[model samples]
Target chain A: MENLYDVVIIGAGPAGLAAGLYSARAKMKTLILEKDKAGGQIVTTNEVANYPGSIDDATGPSLVARMVEQAESFGAERKKDEIVKVELQDKIKVVTGEKDVYKAKVVIIATGASPRYLGVPGERELTGKGVSYCATCDADFFTDLEVYVIGGGDTAVEEAMYLTKFARKVTVVHRRDELRAAKSIREKAFNNEKMAFIWDSVVEEIKGDGIVEKLVLKNKKTGEITEIDAPEEDGTFGIFPFVGYIPKSELFKDFLETDKGGYLITDPDMKTAVPGVFAAGDIRHKSLRQVVTAVADGAIAAVQAEKYIENTFEN
Target chain B: MVILEKDNFEEEVLNSKGLVIVDFWSDGCEPCKALMPEVEALAEKYEGKVKFCKLNITKARRLAISQRVMGLPTILLYKDGAKIEEVTKDEAKAANIEAMIEKHI
Candidate 1:
């Protein structure tokens, strides 16, 4: 194959970047392809307290920037291109992007997940007006305004707490009576003075002119409908949804084995059922989806890829 | 792209006699930071035909709200001082922004 790379990693997130760094440092020709931006969902996060050994007040963009620098410094070529097709059944994997095609001995699928939407009416039109998925990005715009968060998971409750720092009041609207978040997170949310909850409810519709003005809610347990309007003076309130994530595995579904949730199924070494192909990060069916675990998966995938190449091709 | 300020916004964007794009952004916004380079590259690509400007909402909050841009990374397309179109948040990708530019230009 002409201009063949030793390894080609999809999605320049933490996992892909780490894989690039390791592979390039091992004298393997590596290329990292990203669709939109280098940083994945983590870029929308403001504080990264969970990642060990991180500097005080480390933000997501800063961490991802350092990772990119490390990867590039190790001679991994990174490009901005969205992959449209992949041929993994052959000895040399073929990856087709919107702009170009690539051939590689090893391919890493690190395309991560995106925030799932409520799919209610007007939700799409009102996005970035008064509806947001990233609290760190849009919370400051709602200062002193009432805000509603939709979801009961750790992300939802934690983001609701983050909203309390800026908004006048924060209310959680969940489909169930009890939150699915951890006990520690739920305890902090209950103790917060500005925090409130609407149990057994889901958003029916989002109403607005040019910005969010009202939200209609329906109780699942009781069939009662409630309308919440923005304050007359503020004229608008914020709605943040953190329900769940949908993995970006549509392109790989036909070629790779995936779980029920559409996440790629991989072994302990991040190898997929197909040879010369691997999956990592939140896109893979894994328990923990943190930055720490993602980078660890990337390192392991790269090392395993090296072994696979040596045994199969170098002979 | 020109760094738009409150003082020059009216002169540069409102009074400018062509297609203008103003990227409304803030400090804590990661998407805004990420989209900046792409917008700048577009600016360079359409340098002679289109005018590109960026406004930091952190500095000009009231200006941004007055224009009804209540979010970060809001890309607004204007023609002859009239606001024509806008794409925000998830829709504010490089491809979409380029399509908008191609549509207006």
Candidate 2:
């Protein structure tokens, strides 16, 4: 028989975990389903200084470990299963996973977002070898080495600054003449001695043999192409792409209302247009998508879910 | 404590007094992201009188499916926690949302 739950949460990221914590603590039979490993984006991040009341030594994994422990302690059952489909119209919600099918009275979603990559040559092959999307994860490997950063956004500029702590020098390459980052961050990058800019430029291709050894740069304004060789001392360098992120919501395209870029919408209470559905975390269409905000969304979603079950299913 | 899961969202919001507005959106939706500030503005504008919230479909696929949301950026309005109106993509403008809130509040 399929085990029935009071709440079934998708994804084990901060939002999902938070929802699990709140729901289970409220005495709801909650189950958290994660497609892969838990921790979400925090697993790839190195430092987490912004979370309020967080420990000073809190790294991404460390914080997530604590959250997981907390949620488990509160009686939230977690399983590693990819949800394939769902039947949510009835009073009881059914979630079908790759391994098993489960039922729940309520569901919370917190899948989070995935990194967007530059689809250039050698990118897919050289990932983790020399090419990376997160500077915090790969910065230590490139101590005193030169690094190239793509994009002109706040994340790009901030990551470039973070890279300066380990990299010998950091070069920012943008397709436009000017950076699109905030003025303060741009000013900080400008003042940093280790930071340099390649304006009106785009990375046409990433080339290397087993590792990144050279880059093919294209001047957008002038259309000039040049192959910049890696420094001889290191034989190779790191390339960090800070282009953007795409939400992992392909499975939901058919049912959910999405925007042009495919983000999900929600009201302030985290409820969907449909009577019994709710959403939360980075997956929601929100302006700021930090860890703090995701956790907040989870807490709110859990509370709402509790009330939903109590009133409608009390009979 | 409130648990905002799929089963209980309707009861929680509808049972509460005053206007209840729900924004349905997803990640990777540019226009949805663009309209966030406007939604937040509405939340702030009607803070004391109205209750506002958001639902992400990508993360909450089951919930979205249950609700029968068919597109990006749908909004729902509830009075006393029962859904009274649904705002389609074309009707998701701030003016319309505001008008809906005005009717309930």
Candidate 3:
């Protein structure tokens, strides 16, 4: 009973923190576990304009800090523990973390997702050396230097514009001729003085000595080859890829019902296939993954979890 | 927590007994600041079992360079003073760090 709780939410992102706010406010013995920092993907973001009623000068870190404060105010106990395993077949579920074991009547999985890599050669070796996934975190490193951005989505186009503030020029390389981003975003990128485009192409390899010096590109359609090398005077350049994200749902892969993309499958109410288990946020199978949708999922899951506890344990 | 420097890294971490975690960090890195809270909590939680130390690269560039640490917020897990595992980039989170340390202890 030392580590027992009425509800345990896994993750501390927008979804998990919102669930914690509701779960603890309902007076349930709630605990939220975040293996990494509490903010999840939002921590790496720079601008956050879509969130309704967001504060002035709202940034990813600022918004996450406010969400954490809200959850804490509701008395949700937060901990930093990496959960290694779980047991949810019985009436009471058990979770094993690196530090200790925790038991709970209901469990919410909101672990969210992370950026996906192209898995090409030298991508791993040159990361943090010149290749970066987040322009917000590493754009300053590329000041007055040339940069290459991969992907054609809204995030890619938007981040390309953001990178223009520091990089002297940013060339977006995509596998398709047209961008998949919204019209407004595409227009913004097109209008940017520093933005350039390389269509129907993908990166083959990245190379450098102690840093990123050059990139090898392949034209998918024609099978032609091209390369971009750093200026001799500069010695190195930057490459940012906003390819996409992959769900972080490996922990429950064996038990939870996931989609073809490996996102957790849940009912409209956020209840998973399991009787006492639920999933929410970007980790759950959904059409759109955004802060608003994630927060909505969190609220629903916590309410459903509260109902499950009352119906199963109290009655 | 112990402050790591070129002069004391050998005596304080290398010569020490049991598992030790040497965290390499810089001042301007946002991730390093975000992780400090959890580091304090974990060090307290594992007080008697493991030793935690930190080295600011600006202050101890020689020690950091010798380890081949190319990024900020890099964590090296040492068992009885030898490097066993290193975490950087996305893998350098609180949970992964704890799990790696648990392996050594």
Which is the leading candidate under DockQ?
1
TM-score of the A chain in candidate 1: the value is: 0.96
Which should have the higher DockQ, number 1 or number 2? 1
Q: Residue-wise lDDT of candidate 2 within A285-314, one digit each (tens)? A: 999988899989999999999999888989
> Least lDDT summed over 10 consecutive residues: which range in candidate 1 chain A?
A134-143
Taking the tens digit of each residue's C-alpha lDDT, what string does model 1 give over B1-105?
A: 889999999999889898999998888887788789989998999899989999988778768877888777799999988898988887887788889988878
Could you tell me every candidate's TM-score relative to the true structure? 0.96, 0.70, 0.84
Q: What local lDDT score does residue A122 receive in model 3, on the 0 to 100 scale?
A: 95
DockQ of each: 0.68, 0.01, 0.21
Off by over 4 Å in 1: none
Model 1, range A13-93, lDDT digits (tens) per residue? 999999999999998999999987788988888778789998998988999999999999999999988899999889999
Instruction: Compare the candidates by TM-score and give the number of the best one.
Output: 1
Better of 1 and 3 by lDDT: 1
- Model 2 TM: 0.70
Looking at model 3, residue A32 earns an lDDT score of 96
